[model samples]
Target: MTDLAALRAALQLQWALGQEILALVQREHLALTEPGQRSGSAFEFFRQRLHLLPRLEEAVAALRRHRAAWQQLSPALRRSDPEIGALLRANEDLIFRILLLDRENQQLRLRHGLLTVRAESHPHSNRSTSGQFSALA
Candidate 1:
């Protein structure tokens, strides 16, 4: 396929993956907020993401290859191609939203006792911890 064709395909895949991941995060956010839905909520979010992992990896590799193709395209072409430009714009918007949602999810996790602020985050404490504790730090 042509470089333009490949770039288009890669952008499409990236957009799809971003949407799916965003949906998963949104679901996790909703799960965290709802009352009386405690059983297996975290596990369900993990299971969906785990199932998406292979597709995500494959898309990453494809995008890496496409990155070279994108670089090969002339700046004029990049500016002129409406579909490619729109896809890139949409991808950027989706990324911004996903980040916002992920931050909200993290705060929700903290509020719901699924996460702790960690020792380092505390102003007075210099204590060392391991595993999840270290992760939070």
Candidate 2:
């Protein structure tokens, strides 16, 4: 039998991590708006976020695997498990919030001229080798 309670706890923990990531993105947006208000160096901010990615991915993958197992059960079994259903709904809501915040952050970055460029686009350009500051920066 699937352990509904353990799955629910995992979902809740994932939701909490999602919330934390959203908060971090918001803080980054605020920092971009107010340069002097930045909490740390850009390297530090990126490092912290990168550190969370693997753990977050693991939790999400685990939840999906457990959910798949639970879904194999009968409808009556699913309906009787109110806590699992509620937690699943709440986790979905958290994911939506995270996506929205991430989109907003991307838009803000674009507005501020932080556009991404492909390395292949400038193959032979040696502007940096000429002892001049890069306009790209």
For model 1, how does the per-residue alpha-carbon lDDT over 20-124 read when each residue is reduced to its tens digit?
988887777777788655444665665665676566556555655655565577888776666876776677677668667766766677776666566226555
lDDT of 2: 0.63
* Candidate 1 CA-lDDT value: 0.64
Q: Candidate 1, after superposition: displacement of residue 4 in Å?
A: 0.8
In angstroms, give how far residue 117 of model 2 lies from its true place: 1.9
Report the C-alpha lDDT of model 2 over 30-120, residue by residue, as the tens digit: 7767888887554554566566656656756666776787788789888878788777777767666755665565455546654344422
In terms of lDDT, the best-performing candidate is 1
* Runs with alpha carbons beyond 4 Å of true place in candidate 1: 36-40, 47-72, 119-137
Q: What is every candidate's alpha-carbon RMSD to the true fold? A: 6.1, 8.5
Deviation (Å) of 16 in candidate 2? 2.1
